[model samples]
Target: MKPWILGLTGGIGSGKTAVAQAFIDRGVHTVDADHAARWVVEPGRPALTKIVEHFGAEILQADGTLDRAALRQRIFAVPEERRWLEALLHPLIGQEIASVLAHAESPYAILVSPLLIESGQHRLTQRVLVVDAPEALQIERTMARDSANEEQVRAIVKAQADREERLRHAHDVLSNDRDLAWLDREVERLHTFYLSLRGGQA
Candidate 1:
């Protein structure tokens, strides 16, 4: 049988990675969409070749790797460019994610993605689990973690689905507005819940 997939998502700096790490610690098989995205565009990959063809070789670093920061800036600044890139990469990334999940040996698996809802990845899962935090906190955390200024972080936040919309669509909500200890407890609780769910399905 196909393993149950929990679609995990959050806006930038919403502590999604922390929650995913907690699940990983518990031996949950996890497939990260971001990792799949990178994998598709790795050097010598067809996706990278197509990207270079469309965006030019300058988008590559000296080591011949994609200049991710430059690509990010370009996509954010130009809607057409972003659409073109997404059109090229999204299918490849989706195929890679599917292949990874198919090999999952755990009773269930986690598909962690920042754009789970936006990219419609939630459709691939049995449930949607959102890691939520206040917008101000998200901005602050992103600024510190990404070394991005307030304006840039705010723009990213704005580009994403609003907090209310994400929560509205969630089957589970993990509030990340508190300390790590609190977050740990919540993760533990959810882990138990997921295990119980898997048992029931089995």
Candidate 2:
């Protein structure tokens, strides 16, 4: 049988990665949509071939790898191009996510994604878990980690589903405004809760 799946999501700069790592520490298997998205467009993949055909070879690096930064600039600046890329890549990423999630041997598996709600990836899960922090906190964290300016971080936050929207869909919410100790404790509590829910439907 397919394992119980939790959709863990949050906006950029939120503590999704930290919470995901905490779950991993507890032996939970996680399928990250961001990783799946990257995998689908790797060199030698059919998606890469199609992307090259559409965007031209200039989209690739000197080493023949996809030039992700260039492509990111293009798509974010052009909505049509973004839609086209999403149309092509989303299904492939979904397939990869499903394949990995099905094989999870833990009591339950987590599908960790920033776009879990926006991309419809939440449909794959039995419940949704949202990692939340304040907008200012998100922007600050992102700017520090990515070395991005405040404007850039704010733009990213704006592009993602708003805090209210994410919270509206959450079956569980992990507030990440505190330190790692609080996060670990919350994760431990949730881990035990999820384990109890194993074999039960959402």
Candidate 3:
């Protein structure tokens, strides 16, 4: 059977990571774009060169590592800077993800990409799975998880597509505003459905 590559995405603070973790618990191979993005731009990577050229050396910390906080501050203040950063990192991350997918032996793999739609990389996958919650829930969760202020969380969420936009891209949607037990049940059901789909039984 051809491997099913599912693009899993959502707005920031949408609990997509939790859903990805659930898939991992079920033994599904997961290639997380966040991890890939971080990996590809480590101090010596070519992508880091591009970033330094565009954003300058100030984005580098005293340890010569990428200062993610500084980068976030710059990009969030200037929309075009965010776009430039995305353009620089997305391709590199996508390339690495494709390499991983090529060697994946699982019946299916979940590609966790926060920018699945915005980055236009969702085309690499067979289906889009959206993990969603309300904007208010998103802000609340982000604030709680990152210990960030409401305005900061809202700013990040605002950078992503709204709930409707994300919903429109989804082949399947999991609403994650409920309790953990409910989310677990939803993940189990989705896993079963994915297995069936891979087996040509769905």
Candidate 4:
């Protein structure tokens, strides 16, 4: 049987990355979608070749790596282009995530994706975990972490579903605004909860 897989998601700066890290610290096997996306497009990978064929070599950097900056700009500025790119990349990413999950040794595995809900990948998991924070805090965190200005942060946030909609999809929600200790406690609680779900007494 497959390990129980949890889909972890949240808005732009809702601390999903931190929550995933916390799970990893507790010995959970975590697969991050962003890393998988990057892996699929590495210099000599098949995905990179397909991207180059579709978008042309102009999107490649001098090092022959996909120019992520250019690609992001292209997709953000063009909705149709974004959809096209997503169609190309999502299947490849899904395949890699499946492969990783197939070999996972943990009782549960976390498939962390910023766009888990938006991309409908949430349906593939046994549980959906959301890391939540207030909108203002999300904006502030995004600005600080990405070195983005207020407008840019807001634009990014606007592109995502609102807090209420995300909450609707959550099988578990962890509020991350308080402090690391609070988060750690929540993580511990969830670790116990996950263990129980997996028929383990830990």
Candidate 5:
């Protein structure tokens, strides 16, 4: 059977990885959708072969890996390309995530996905935990981390579910607009709560 799951999500640059790491620090088994997406496109993978056939060798690196930055730029410029890529990768990533989660021995597992709500991945979990930050802050963080321009970063943010929609679907919200010390404490608090939920389900 699939394990009990907590779907953790946020807008790009909302510190979803930080929150997921905190859960990992507590020894939770976590599956990341982004990581799964990359896995399906590794060199020699069927998805990678298809992407090469569609986008040409320019989409690949010298090492034959997907040139993620180049592909990101192309898709960002063309909505149709983005949709096509999503259609090809989403199902493969879902299968990989499901396989990992089903065998998870943890009391419960955490599924972290930036597109959890948008792609309907929340259906795989019993609960949704949203990591939220202001839009400006998300833009700033993405620019700093990705070396992306404000216009591009803002475009990515606009593509995600807005703050209110995420909150409306959230069973729990982790506000990450502040200090990491605060984040540390909040993770502790939520960790205890999730443990109790697993017990209750028993």
Candidate 6:
């Protein structure tokens, strides 16, 4: 049988990476969708070629790699362009995620994604785990971490699913309003819970 897959997700700056790292400490395998997304559009890949064809070479940096900041600004400003990019990248990212998960050796694995629910990637997992924080807090955290301004962070929060909507889809929710120590403890608790579920002890 295949290892159980946990779909882990959160809005920007919601501490999903910290939680995922905690799981990794307990020997759980993890796949990050963002990494897969980037991989699918590498310098010489088909996705990059198609993207350049559609968006023009202007989307690329001086080093011939994608200029993510420029693309991000373009997408958020124009919804259609975002949709076009997602249409091209999501399937390729999905395939890469599936390929990585298939080889997971842990009793269970994690698929970490910022757009897990919104993009329907949660369907690949047995359970949905949402790392949640208030919208205001999310904005603050994101701005601080990314050196982004309030307006840019707010725009990203606006584009993502709201807190209530994300909570509605979660089988498990990790609150990230506190410090890393608190977050680590919460992850440990969930790790134990998942292990019990995996072993049929719960």
For model 3, the superposed segments whose C-alpha errors exceed 4 Å read: 53-56, 73-83, 198-202
| All models, RMSD in angstroms | 2.3, 1.5, 2.6, 2.3, 2.6, 2.4
Q: How many residue pairs collide in each prediction?
A: 0, 0, 0, 0, 0, 0
What are the per-residue Cα lDDT tens digits for candidate 2 across 66-156? 9999999989899999999999999999999999999999989999999999999988888999999989999999999999999999988
> How close is every model to the real structure, measured as TM-score?
0.89, 0.94, 0.85, 0.92, 0.85, 0.87
Backbone clashes, candidate 1: 0
Top model by TM-score, which number? 2
lDDT of the candidates, in the order given: 0.90, 0.92, 0.87, 0.87, 0.89, 0.89
Quality of model 2 by C-alpha lDDT? 0.92
On the 0 to 100 scale, the lDDT of residue 111 in model 5 is 94
lDDT of 1 by residue, 30-82 (tens): 99999999999999899999889988999999999999999999998999999
Poorest 10 consecutive residues by lDDT, candidate 1: 193-202
- Please, what are the lDDT tens digits per residue for candidate 5 over residues 9-42? 9999999999999999998899999888888998
Ranking by TM-score: 2, 4, 1, 6, 3, 5
lDDT of 1 at 91: 85
Model 1: residues >4 Å from true position, as ranges?
Answer: 198-202
Clashes of 2: 0
Candidate 4 Cα RMSD (Å): 2.3
- In model 5, residue pairs whose N, Cα or C atoms come closer than 3 Å (at least 3 residues apart or on different chains), thus clashing, are none
Please estimate how well model 5 matches the true structure, expressed as its whole-model Cα lDDT: 0.89
Winner by lDDT: 2
- In model 1, pairs of residues that clash are none
Candidate 2, residue 127: the lDDT equals: 92
Tell me the lDDT of model 3 at 124: 83
Higher-lDDT candidate of 2 and 6 = 2
Write model 4 residue lDDT over 1-202, tens digit each, in one string: 5688899999998888888888999889989888888999999889899889988999999989999999999898999999998998888889888888778888889899888888778766888889999999999999999999999999889988777888998988998899888888899999889977852223
